[model samples]
Target: MNVRREGTAAKAAAPTKTSGPPASLREAGAALAGLSAVFLFEMLDNSILNVALPTIGRELSASATVLQWVTGVYAVVFGGLMLALGALADRVGRRKVMLVGLVLLGAASLATAFVTTAEQLIAVRAAMGVAAAMTTPGSLALAFRLFDEDGLRVRATTLISTVGLAGLAIGPTAGGLVLAFAPWQVLLLVNVPVAALAFIGIRRGIPADQASGPHRAPTDRAGALLGTAAIVLALLAPTLFVDAGAASPLPWLAAATAVVAAVLFVARERTARHPLLDLALLARPLVSSGLAFKAAASLATAGLGYLVTLQLQLDWGWTPAHAALGMLPQVVVLIAGGALIGPLITRVGLDGAARLGAAAVVCGLAVYGLLGRFGYGWVALALALVAAGMRVVGVVAGTNVMRGLPADRTTVGAALVDTVGEVTTGIGIAVSGTVLAKLLTGDIATATWSTQQTARFHEAVTRAGLTLTVLAAALVGWGISRARRPGAARTASSPGH
Candidate 1:
């Protein structure tokens, strides 16, 4: 496994002219601000939609399946296209690709405001997802151009990451606040102005993508398309199965199609001249573990977000705003946890930090499983632990993965990071959504369920959450253990190192 070297592929592909005024703290701040706006909006969109979903369903008369698609489709499309687009960004220009993405995002978001049906809304969300895929990788990759020094770059990365968490933390609150005074469509429209602002900032602050000399390899269209097909099929199956009969063949057919697409994608990657993504990276423990751990973190955070929003609004009869406010404690802990990760890493090595994070997730899940029967107050406490765990995993995993990658492969590596995160988040929501639907189906089918049934439904939801969290926790622990192995290589330039 090749450790990432400074100024290898990235420098060659997106070379910065050194002749002008040297990059300053001001430029770095500007760059981060622009990128943060884009990241925050994307994260906010997901969280806000989760909060507003119940309301949308009531208004549109959407079925449970349509609601899941509204959320899951975004992640699926975003994850599917990012690798190909990331490669394109590296070859063409990150700034240019990002600007195009912002424009598309703004337009799509504005169009979504007029979507009158559940199907139209789902389609618009998918378009937004494609735009997000284009923007996210460039948002992170462009930081390399803004900050020349490794120390400065790492600091910028941390801030960008923290802001992402902040977006997650604030989503429910923001959505709830908006829903109080306006229609739920406001949630989709809000992105229009945010995207426009991001566009202006990025166009002014971000440098142009200089051409890499003629030796760069060609893009892998086959691998990219196949991978996208696989993801679309994979994400579609679970949502479809949730509403279908146990004996239905559609779910099995979709799952098999996904498997076939995945196999073909892998086969194509192994032989492609310029693969959409390199399979060899998985052979390195650090890169592989980082990917797995990030997925696990998403499972804990996104899954919890989906479940809690429903538990508060649907089961407990809380207003959207009230449900959003109920999550304040978790957000607070997420902020604190982000602030403390550097110190914790200093006290404990990366491996130790990850283990702590994995354990925290498990502890949080255990609390939810055991004591969630008491009240949402207890669930909030569990959320705090999960938030802390997310912080630790979010910080440690990305840096370690980058450290393990070859510098030339940085663009793809970075894209994969975001892809893993988005994809797992989608999976998390799907899995949790399925479980909740299954648990509540009988209750929901009754003309009117008793209060006892409602209470039981809530308990069942919590238990299911616990089951998912435990499974996620185990995956995270396995990744951490793999990363700790003696042969696991490290990059000297990695932030925590």
Candidate 2:
């Protein structure tokens, strides 16, 4: 197997000024709009559907387990297929793969109108997950390829992420409002129009792929199978923990399966001639460190969000609507913070910006762990700080990952960044939920809790928050060490580094 160092391959892949005008947000407005829509679907679909689950249950006469699968299956399939499909995109054509995925997304979403059973909806959601796997990595990869300048790449990424973040933040509320007037099916059917818009924009704005010859290496089928099995099992373990509790052997078994698959997958990649993901590329300081930073940010964000939502609704006696409103601080900061990323990256280099953002997330988690029980003010402050941190780290870390890879590998690199975030987010939520289940005696979803139960709930929150804080801090420290290694100074800023 021939493996090129990240620095050498990056230098070879760097685009010159004469390559043509750099694809700025203004110049690539249509493509960016389309890509933003793709991300919006991914972020919005689950959040919005979650709000309508009760309604779906009533409509379909579904049990709780079926309802869980309705959402769980989508995440499992989406996370599992991302890396393999990303490699496929790199080999075949990013634009071609993305367009086909949009078509599938549209068709699957349209099928929502005809679905009558919970099983059918699960099937449709799984199909949508497949579509997401195909399109999401391409969105980032295509956007990175569009821009020749690192600064433009940062700004473009920030813009796309902002749109998706907005969708995530508002999805629940939007779904509730829509359900008030329309059927639950409308929530998913909305994707048809979104897919259509993305399809048109991508077809017109993005250029066609330049084909690689037939002599290109074939994809490593064994690596793809092992990689997908590992991720699917890893993602499944958390949901199993939440549903089956810690004492149940099912979650533990799933966790063991995940670990074994991951080990075997690594061994496969190391030996494969045309590996789905070249493990050596991850040795690059920027690539690995950037992924570490993203994982840290995602872990903190998801855990905090899950814990705080429960705190407000179950423990504090806030209504669902009120709890949603309470989360406004995070949404506000995430949306408004995009303007700050460029200035921050300009002041601090990308690596510095990533470290700063990661530190803020740790601090935010600490605040919640220590002081959140005192008042809503502390909780709000924690939310804003974490949101701000995530905003910065999300853009800079992803850009750094893209910058570290050669042109042909950007899709898979983007997949790696996303896969890290997905897995860590699942772990974070699982850890928090499992801790709460172990500590609290009664049903957590009950409207009224005894003083003892409430106290236990608060303790659970503190323990979970602090645990996540320590883990995130460790990840950030590791990332900082990696970023400071020799040759790490050759960042995207130089363009010709």
Candidate 3:
């Protein structure tokens, strides 16, 4: 065959084998709507559980420690499963796994409503977490497979972001409202309908891609185990530290194990015929740098979120509803910014978008740090500056990192991004929460005067906020430092024309 003719033939065969969803506008719209339902399920799960916690504790007589587990288990289990399940989605079928996750999550939610005891509730919570672990990677992987074009992916992701924002806005309020009208059962039960809807839509909308299985080399079982162990233990580290701290054997032992596992994972994957993860791929500057940038951005966002909520409710005495409402501006800006940045980045390039976004995070965190360190007040007034700053930080960094990578790696990429983000958030909240709690404990003990006591309380609260903001700043700076490597310049924006 003529070399040029052979090249042309290969190109012709590629479209037939690898075309995504139908190119028709209507087909694309249907697919996006399905993805929106998936987003709703995820966001609702993420945001609604907080309100349900108080109710959960009340009904089950759960201790403060156990209550924390209610939220943290989901993160731990989901983080653990990222690498393993992400590869599963690629090899088995993203559409199949995604739908299964939706159904499982919904069913777990429904079952959680009837828990009569703390252990039952904890068990159900773990089940719900596994469901989330299964859900996110597959849905993200499908987005990559379903929309192969850069512009289309951006449009889809932007809409997905919008669904996320809406869910975040509505879930807490909806949880509050549900509790007011119904019992604690209603909190978990509400997920049933949302997840079911997503499951149905996904079943109908997503087409089956070719499967990877026995025909390919054996699966990477050892790498999966090691990587899962590393991530899961890392997420649990902070909570464990709450009890163990640095001096205790458990936390230190856990960390040592993770480090050893990491070394083993690196060694095994380097030589395995069918390694669990392709560590070599991450060695690429494009992969490693993008991962770092995204991780930093997420850490800043989570820190800002925790600090804002604390400052509003504890320091400023806002009602829970008001506390949730304070997030409105950030949500609005994040939604808008996330949608717009894809196209802008497509024009501007990845590194430019990343640098621009990282700069925004720096500004936002600085303002937040100042506010946290100063005198506090009424909710509406105190947030006037800090809210916008945090939101801008969230949007710019979130979009920049996602746009920096390739479509083929999206599942592992997204899971890696999410794992780093949640782990950071968990650690930040755990550390900051500890400091705030300890300072309060010490100050209340050593009060010389009532006047000084009130001032001390405010000061401790301010310091807590400052702590998180400082951490946020450090992460954003790290993002800026490592961004120039490999794929950080791609700028694949979501939700665009």
Candidate 4:
């Protein structure tokens, strides 16, 4: 098997300087808008849809399990196919693949209006998942390619994420409001216009694949299959655990299958010529550490959001509307935190920003575990801290990962970052849910709990929250150690290589 030489790898990773003036976000213009829309759709789709699930169930006469699949299928498909599609984009054309995805998104979303059955809706959602797989990774890769300077990359990423985070923060409330007057189908129909805007902006703003000199490596079909299977099973295992409980053997079987498949995929990649993902590239300090930070942030964010939602509604007896409002501290921090990115980077550098942000996430989780049961103020504080930390690490760590990879591999690298986040988010929620199921003797869905049941619920929340805190802290600690290594700091600071 051939390995990329150290010098060759460095040369490939270095930014190619042009004779013209340096690139800026201003020059990106419509391309940034297009990328932002792509992210917005990814973040908003499920959050908004979750609000309409009960309505969807009632209208379609769907069962509880089927309603869960309406959302679960999208996540499973999207997470599973991202790496394969990202590799395809690198070999083919990122812009071309992205445009095709936009068309599919619009078409599938339009199909919602005609769907009367749960099965049909599920199929439509699965198609949208495919579209998401094709586009989400490229959004970051293309943004990185748009600017030669690391600062510009960070700024561009910050801007794009702000839009996406805004969508995530507003989706539930917006969907609730829209449902008061409009049909649930209208929630999906909104994607049609979003897709159109993205298509127009990308077509006008980005150049064709041939213009930038696309990669010509042969596609690795075996690696793609194995990798897809591994990811799909890994993602599926969490849902099974949440729904099936620990007593069931199905989730364990899925998990073991995922591990075996992942091992096979690694063996294949190590030996295959023109592998879908070059394993050696991932060994680089920046790449691995950046992914760790991203995983930590995602784990904490998803776990905290899930636990807190349950706490407010199920444990504390708050209404859904009130709980949504209760979450404003997090929503506000995530949206308003964009302004802090540039200044934070300016003061601490990317490595510093990531470490600080990661540390803050650990601290926030600890606070929630220790003091969240005391009062709402504690919960709000915990939420704001985690959101602020995630807001920074989400942008900086991703930029660092892109910087560590070769020009041709940026899309795959982005996929890896996203894949880590997706997998860890699932694990985080699984851990929280599994613990609650094991500890709370009463049904969580009951309208009211007995006094003893309530005490057990509080104990479950504390134990689960602390468990997640320890896990997140371990990941952040590993990330910090990786960043502090001899040459990692230099590599992170100097983007030109």
Candidate 5:
């Protein structure tokens, strides 16, 4: 890849002339604070509704499957759109696109608060997904762009990622507090002021950067459609067959369409003047493996979060705050893993890091799965294990991708990182949600379950758990074992390689 500067760090520091003199550290701090607020909102919003799932259902009389739409819809749409929007940021100014995203996000949150019916709520969540899709990619891309020093960029990235888990760390507690005094509607409404504050801050504090060249790159319209089609199909396939009473042929047809679209997407990326995404990057083992590891990491973490929240509320009758707060240990270890031990592990190479870390995730999953089969008492201890495992996975996987890419591609790469993460997370939520839904509908309740229904619940949960665990293990091995290729053949500066 041809970079304007080959060094690991950006050469020029922030100019005091363009944006007033707040001092470098002060400026970086403000930028970080801005991102912290915005990033947490983006991250926590994913599962804040999840903690309230059971309570919302009881209040609104939502069906088992419909309740999950609150979380599932947001994930699928947000993840799918990010890939397109990432490219958009590269082509346009990240700041302008960011402000637009913030406005939409704030408005959507307000709209979510007013939603009354299950369908309205689902639609609002999907709208929020779109807002997030636009806002999040630009923000992350800009974080990498704005921070000139590698040390600062790395620290900023760790901070951005850490706060997301921190949001999850407190989401249940916050949701509970909100539900205690106010309707669940207040939960979403809170996002508006936070987003508005962020919007105002970003407009005033952040300076404009150089724009993409005058020659408009062709929008990867077809590729965008294809990518969206694949995710929609993957998420809807099981749900359509199980929930909608759709014909068997319809689900398979959807899957077939996705396969065809993917083929077209790759072909288009290779030939297009301005491709939506560079699919050729997948030829690099580290990049491809990074994507796969990202997917695998989400599956493990999402599954753990999903089951823990459900078990606490549905089985043991814990409060939402209790359920949410109960996950604190997992959060702590995850943060430590990313910030502290990750760099040391990567110093040894990606394979060693992935091997140790991926195995840690499997061991954690197996332990938690076993504990889940019994009762709630074993949770806190088991979660410690889960945290350590997930932390390793996140740290190693992130290092694999971030360190391997060129400095200039940081914007697109960060967005791509988010895209892979969200898509995998969306898939995990959908798959696990499907399993939980089936169990809930059948007879998995602690008090009100028939023998046959109980059997069905176990069967479904077992299937989901086993499938995720197996895939996590296999992908971890595959990702770590593969030979990594050099960074991209085509960099931003190298117009003619």
Candidate 6:
């Protein structure tokens, strides 16, 4: 196989203005509408499933272990394939790839909704993971191409993040509403119409964005396979430990395989002419630091959201609809925080914004841990604080990550952020769920509990909150150092301080 030189390929793929009228509200409106739909679908798919897990388990007679796989498998496959698929989007046209993904996602959702068995549902969900990998990076890459100016790009990113986070924030409420009238399958079916509109938007609204010139390298098959396998094994191993006994050999085997695959991936990427991920890109301080903060945010929030749902619906004996309503405050705060991102960044600079968000998270989680046992009302307030902080940090971190990346590598940048999110989200769930399971002496679906078990469960929640607080504090410390470094204040245009 012939390999294109890196410099020549980079020059060929360099940024060029799209073939359309200059960036205007009309164009941005169309692009945002499409991108939001795609992002919303992906987020809703993940969050809605969390609310439906118990219902699905009851219907399918799924064991605790099988149920874990049902949820965890999607993240494993989606995150694992993201980098490779993102690179693929750059090589092909971002819009073209995204349109295809939208179609496939719709088809997969239809199939998943109709599945009769737990095993079949998991398999179809895995297919949806593949579809998400194809779309996630492409959506962000297209947004970059759609808006050439830095200000416009930042604004577009802010809106995109807002839409995606809203989906996550509202999914339980939406799912609960659907389940009130329909079966658990409606959660899976809901993606179809949204995906259909997204397909039309990508096809008609978003302009084409593909690398030009003759020096592009062929797809990196070896690196893609190795990277995908490494992530899947690594993420899957933790879920096993969460559901299966720690004494089980399967988790150990999976971990070892993951390590081996990861080592081989590093070796292959260093030598491969067209690596799936540009290893050098990962070394940049902006990229690395942004990823660290992003992962930390996801790790803390994803697990907390899952636990909150369980606590409300199971421990507190609230109905699903009521539990969903309980989440509204966080969603409202997130939207407000999203709108304030640009102003906040301008006021405090990028690093300062991240530090502030981190500080808020730490303070909120600490207070929640101390008082969460009092009532669900207090827990809602804590979640609102966490959600606001997460939105502020998330928007800034994304802007920083994308701003640091070369125009030629938008898809790679997008994929890196997403992969970090998916892995850490899985880790958060595994750690929190495993602790709860251990304390309760039952599965996650336990319908009844003894007073002693309930007390232990509260202890687990408090421990999880404390752990997240410590992590948030550490992130703020790192951000402060990054801000204080010499020459860190170079560019007003750069998102990072």
* Residue 378 displacement (Å), model 2: 0.8
lDDT of each: 0.76, 0.91, 0.64, 0.91, 0.66, 0.77
Off by over 4 Å in 5: 1-27, 51-68, 112-123, 212-216, 238-253, 307-328, 335-355, 368-382, 392-396, 399-409, 429-442, 446-466, 483-497
* Model 2 whole-model lDDT (C-alpha atoms): 0.91
| Better candidate number, 2 or 5, judged by TM-score | 2
| Model 3 steric clash pairs | 154-493, 154-494, 154-495, 155-495, 155-496, 286-487, 342-493, 350-489
Candidate 6 per-residue C-alpha lDDT over 128-234 given as tens digits, one digit per residue, 9 for 90 to 100: 98889999887876776676565576677778877887788778778878888899988888889989878877777775653471116788899989988988887
After the best TM-score superposition of candidate 5, give how far the Cα of residue 62 lies from its true spot, in angstroms: 5.9
Query: At residue 107, what lDDT does model 3 achieve?
Result: 80
Candidate topping lDDT: 4
- Per-residue lDDT for 1-497 in model 4, tens only? 13558778889999997644237778788999999999999999999999999999999999999999999999999999999999999889889999999999999999999999999999999999999999999999998888877889899999999999999988988999999999999999999999999999899888777755567899999999999999999999999999999889999999999999999999999999999999997777888889989988999998999899999999899998899889999999999999999999999898899999998898889999999988899999999999999999999999989877878888888989899999999999999999999999967899989999989888988998999999999999888887777867565455443
RMSD of 3: 6.6
Considering lDDT, which of the candidate structures 3 and 4 is the better prediction for this target?
Answer: 4
- State residue 331's C-alpha deviation in candidate 2, in Å: 0.7
Worst ten in a row by lDDT for model 1: 488-497
RMSD of candidate 6 to true structure, Å:
7.9
> What tens digits encode model 3's per-residue C-alpha lDDT throughout 265-313?
8898898887766666565444455555555455556656666676666
Q: Clashing residue pairs, candidate 2? A: none
lDDT of 1 by residue, 1-497 (tens): 23455546667789576655235656556667888888787778888888899999999899987898898888778877888888777676678888999999989988876888999999899999989989987776666446555445545666777787788777777888999999998888888888887888788777665565111678888887998888777767766665663357997798899899999999999999788778987767888888878888877777777777777776677786798687877788877666687677778877677678867877877787677667887889888988888778776777667667655455567788887776676567667766666666564545456877787677677767777777787787679777877657544344432
Error of 3 at 120 (Å): 1.8
Ranking by lDDT: 4, 2, 6, 1, 5, 3
TM-score of each: 0.81, 0.94, 0.81, 0.94, 0.78, 0.84
